[model samples]
Target: KGCTWRTVSVDKIVTRDCHSKVFGDIVQATQPPACLDACGSQKTNTSSSCWVDCFYKAAAGPDSGKPGGKVAGMSFAELTAAWEHPFLPEDQGGCPPVKPKPPWFAHTTSVEQKM
Candidate 1:
């Protein structure tokens, strides 16, 4: 019961925030439907869409006939408009900086002598 209530509360908060003008505008500015569709088509796993992949492909600049080229059926202008938000300066609303990977530690294998 408590878990269900907490889930409902979180959902309501998210829905409310998403419906707000500021958040809605940001989402619309960043992820247009066409861009999402294009990325969805390219996904290896069709069950779910990858927003990160869509953002990268959409921000790939002009069409160059490459695998990750501009989305099909979408003009350069349209792509650019949809891609505007992701390219914004960090202070404005751009992607956060990537964290460095942790150092790798090798595991030691012990050899057992025959009894």
Candidate 2:
């Protein structure tokens, strides 16, 4: 009753070769390889020193290191607007207000993960 749920991110998974030993009968996946969207590159790009150490500091091309300031010459107001997009009114592009559901529910589903 007191089980803890943990999310496994696909980024950390390194795909292993499937053999007959591991799988009894392996059938070709119904969907195309591209459509499967299976995890590929898990490389994490470092942007920690992206602004300070790069030519951006000199040419100032990447001037503002803050988020949403990617455009070469975006004003602070523009940056702020970009950052606060999620908080906009529902009439705008913001997410619709969420209605809380009751604790009691008749329908239920189970999630099973096989490694």
Candidate 3:
């Protein structure tokens, strides 16, 4: 017996239109990089423009100029050095603040007390 495979796509479907209730499990099933889990999302203006600018800046700073960037030229030693250096703001000290514990029967002496 012969076998054949066919590809199919739905034109109108998109992430925005996909309801959480319908695709919540599917969305949750996705496994992002471990680093993403460790590092929460950061806000940025002009996302696409920032990506291009970031690539350029990382190449050799602003003076490197437009179309002057080379991504592959970077060596592993340089990359490793950057990875070891702190990426977070100096004020944060590279660590998120500790969250206070929730009130519970054992932990809570008075839930009624308004802080």
Candidate 4:
């Protein structure tokens, strides 16, 4: 007896507002806030999810991608497009600010300006 496949529910998916062209997948992340330096609204586990999903899809190839990148078959362009939403609402404080921070440094910076 053995598990067949790894099943990640759609609900678990954290959609990021940003997109990446290099990688064909959503960019949702959950490392921490850069501005707040203490949880600026990043979804939990989204970063891991994004990483796994991206790797899986990449290894699967761009021509055989699924989900938003589906075109009856995965395409490089589609994969990249699918990765449009990388940050979930929780991951980010709603729409990304004029300037967004990387997941790892999302909530670890001080917003207060030094005089």
- lDDT tens readout by residue for model 4, 58-104: 44543445555542334556555455434335354332423433568
Stretches of candidate 3 off by over 4 Å are 1-46, 53-71, 87-115
Candidate 4 segments whose C-alpha is farther than 4 A from its true place: 1-55, 58-73, 83-97, 100-115
Model 3, C-alpha of 106: deviation from truth (Å): 15
What tens digits encode model 3's per-residue C-alpha lDDT throughout 1-115? 6998774732222232222222222222232334223333421222345433443344344445647544442355754444332323335322222344453775655757755
True-structure lDDT of candidate 1:
0.42
User: What TM-score, computed on C-alpha atoms, does each candidate reach?
Assistant: 0.22, 0.25, 0.23, 0.22
Q: Which residue pairs in model 2 clash with each other?
A: none
Worst 10 residues of 2 by lDDT: 21-30
| Candidate 2 residue lDDT tens string, 23-107 | 1111112113341223233111113343123323222224445575553543456445543443455465443344444546335
lDDT of each: 0.42, 0.32, 0.36, 0.39
Count of steric clashes across candidates, in order: 0, 0, 0, 23
Looking at candidate 4, the ten consecutive residues that score lowest on lDDT are: 27-36
Give Cα distance to truth, residue 47, candidate 2, Å: 11
Candidate 2 structure lDDT: 0.32
Output the number of the TM-score-best candidate: 2
Against the true structure, what is every candidate's RMSD? 16.6, 19.2, 20.5, 19.5
Pick the winner on lDDT between candidates 1 and 3. 1
